[model samples]
Target chain A: MPDLAASSKRPPPWALRILVLTYLTIFLFAPLLALGVESFREGALSLWQGITEPESLLALRNSFLLAAIAVVLNVLFGIAAGLVIARQRFWGRALLDGLIEVPLALSPVMVGLAFILIFGRTGWLGPWLSQFGVRVIFSFPGLIIATLFVTVPFTAREVIHVLSEIGEEEEMAATTLGASRWQTFWHVTLPNMRGALSCGISLTAARALGEFGAVLIMGGAITGSTHTATTWIFTAVDERNNGAALGLSLVLGLCSVALLLLVEKLRARAHERR
Target chain B: MRPALTPTSRWSLLLRGAVIAWMLLLVVLPLVALAIHGLRSGVPFFWAAITEPQAKDAVALTLWTALLISLINAVLGTATAWLITRYRFRGRRLLATLIDLPLAIPTLVTGIMLVVLFGPMSPLGAWFEGHGIYVAFHSPIIVLALGFVTLPFSVRMVQPVLADMDRAEEEAAASLGASRLVTFLRIIWPSIGPAVLGGALQTFARAMAEFGSIVVVSGNVPHETLTAPVYIYGQVESGDSHGAAAVALALVTLSLLVTLFSKLMVRWGVRRHA
Candidate 1:
């Protein structure tokens, strides 16, 4: 630690510190504390009852299920995409690099709308797909697609960043030792990227778990069918079921905080290893 | 000279092609589809969708709140980043975790947090209502929600740059009898300026397209608090896909421009840092 205090030879600006504390408290912590209190106002039993309701339970289940599937898909795709971009010099690489961030830059709603335009009944491919009895929109498939779209870049970006930094020396050494390409990738590359991969997957899972706008638009938020925990919370609030809303919101918040903590841990561990 | 394709090279080629195709199908195709759908009805209808009074209000409110929130975020985020990067503080790790809460939590819950904190039912909310200061179902609440969602952007962006920055200049200034403020203004500001602006640009883009949190807080009041995303949502729900597409196109265009600008800034910052 550089002794900022000694260097300045002065006490810290207490006023500025207090201002930041006050601002964050008002904007972040206060709301969360209020949410906690409201969720528990009716006691733990009610909070339990709220999430245990069949619809809420189903919604929670769907959210977790979708997140799991999306995480798996994204990780696989991320590995392939990350390797291509990080290891290979190719034409249009810059364009592909730019495309990775397209999902992040656009609104979740816009992503959802794009799905609608691609997979909805009146969509370009929708009619053709429907001829074979395939349903994409207003279903689990829609939820998966939406979650995948929003989180598509997370794992890939992380892996690519890690791969680029670590370079290809280890893999080249392995290959020169007569190791097969797959052997080099698995033994040399995968181990090096494990920490970053986990961090990215966790981050993607967290984002997928909380996705709303795209899911709402693509899945249509149909209760007991396509409804996610987030969509359910939205409906609960809209229907004036504040108790249920607060309880579900608390549940979601807790899970997310836990996941974020995990991400931080993974990130710190990766940094130390690096 | 072009090398003949070996088995390993062929396999790698296949992998690259697969990843590229996957990305094209996942992001590029959907986006192209949206662009086509949005413009299918021609420019006159697109003009009409955007020129509607309600639509105009939504666009205006989105831009206004996004600007305010990004400015607030830039100043406060920079301060928070400075404190964390410069000082040895207790609970700094915990504070840093809290800053990333929004990224992990479902954004919809952000709105619920605000509602529970400032809704008419809570004590504080009731008191505010008694004093005729409304929060929920209003525009300021939208700004607050956006601020919460984007709070981490600038801080996260600047922290690494600040951490890696040479403190020798500041120490030299201090040794030369320069005030702390002068040291910061003369040495620190220029170093972190590009990063803060880059992060602020991304934050602004995020705020403009923010939906889940704002929807829950803003009450979607027509011509008052409804943002472009929510308005697009309403248009979609009402079976007005064209109208939704028009607004979505506008928001996407704005976000892409901001994202491109931010990317340029990132390049500039990296170059300058080097």
Candidate 2:
């Protein structure tokens, strides 16, 4: 590839570099640093106090638990969705393709509201389900469902991309060797999609960890019951417990940064392999 | 092609049906429920729900912030992408990773980061307040927070295109004495135009649907800072399910349109280039 910069002899590289770095510093790094300082402003003991507080710990635990649940569910459903979408030819396939992306674009709050409209007391499924003493909204199930809804596309999209690129040749070969569909999928397709599937899981888990709007709406932000870490931070902020809020944010931020680095590594590995 | 009813084909069909059923139960049904519930009170109620002063302001704020973020992100994101792709420099990898940082961080933490940095209690925030400017609980803060959340979309979207693009046209144009800006405008802009547009639209949709970060930063002040998603959440919390659903549906519909539009644009661009 020709070097556009070397050939064009554009303005000094430093100018553009400085501009880009300055923008990022002002917008991205600065706020994060500020939070870092605030979180530890009162030193290690205070940070520990904030994090080890029962409510904070429970919220953190809930966030991980809910995210893990969503990740497991997404892995199962997402692979199936990815396989069918990538490999199949059928009517209305394009419509499904479009619809699957809806969650990414739609508001999480709306996603939660949609579930409530179906599962809330006055909802279509509420009365029927209530007869069986089943509850969804304002519960852990609701939190998982909302997180699942918001994160539905990540794994499926990643797997679809990987599958599309890997194509159907190997699966066809396996089938021609008299392998059943299940065996072919498990042996041939799944191995090929492992990288993307893992990446998708990481992405899904990270997103679910950070999810707020949908969970807050669906789970109703009931402390010690439905409140995830993000909601707890919000509550901390609301109650003017800035130290606790900032501390929780610091922990979540670090975890996510680790996840981001993992994603970056995966992306780099994928590109290198490609 | 002839439709086959062989056992293998039947099994494949069953798998496909299973995926479809899962999607219907999880994705489609809830959306349909939301639509039905939102409109259950008829045209007048839906109209009133969306047109209430707070609802109207929320909608307006959502659009205004989304548009502002799109424009800002387009310029900065494109520049960042350009810098990274065209010019290799020290810390390029680190810069790229940092750019993707917001993606991994929970967005509610993003709001908290802003508060830690710029809330009234902080020294910098206090200085800004003294100057009659504010970051938290302001419309501009919403734009800023959403900008951070949506930061990676345009750059990530456009980066791959630039990497794969043939730089010969740019080199040739520059060799012909075309100025840097003119050469970029003439040669580069046309190539990446659709990509930037698509990314910008996606960014806009993301900003529009942003709830978690906005809720934390906006202080949820009615009519003043409450965004559409936050407003819907507030409505639900306030026991106005119909109103929340109506607004949620409107936001969902708008986002779906934008997302689909961006998808169409990308497809068209690919076909055009092909």
TM-score leader: 1
The two-chain DockQ for each candidate, comma-separated, is: 0.53, 0.54
The C-alpha local distance difference test score for the whole of candidate 1 amounts to 0.85
Clashing pairs in 2: none
RMSD of 2: 2.7
Interface RMSD values, listed in order for every candidate: 3.7, 3.8
TM-score of chain B of each: 0.93, 0.94
Q: What's the residue-level lDDT of B8 in candidate 2? A: 43
Q: Grade the docking of candidate 2.
A: medium
Q: B187, model 1: CA deviation in Å?
A: 2.0
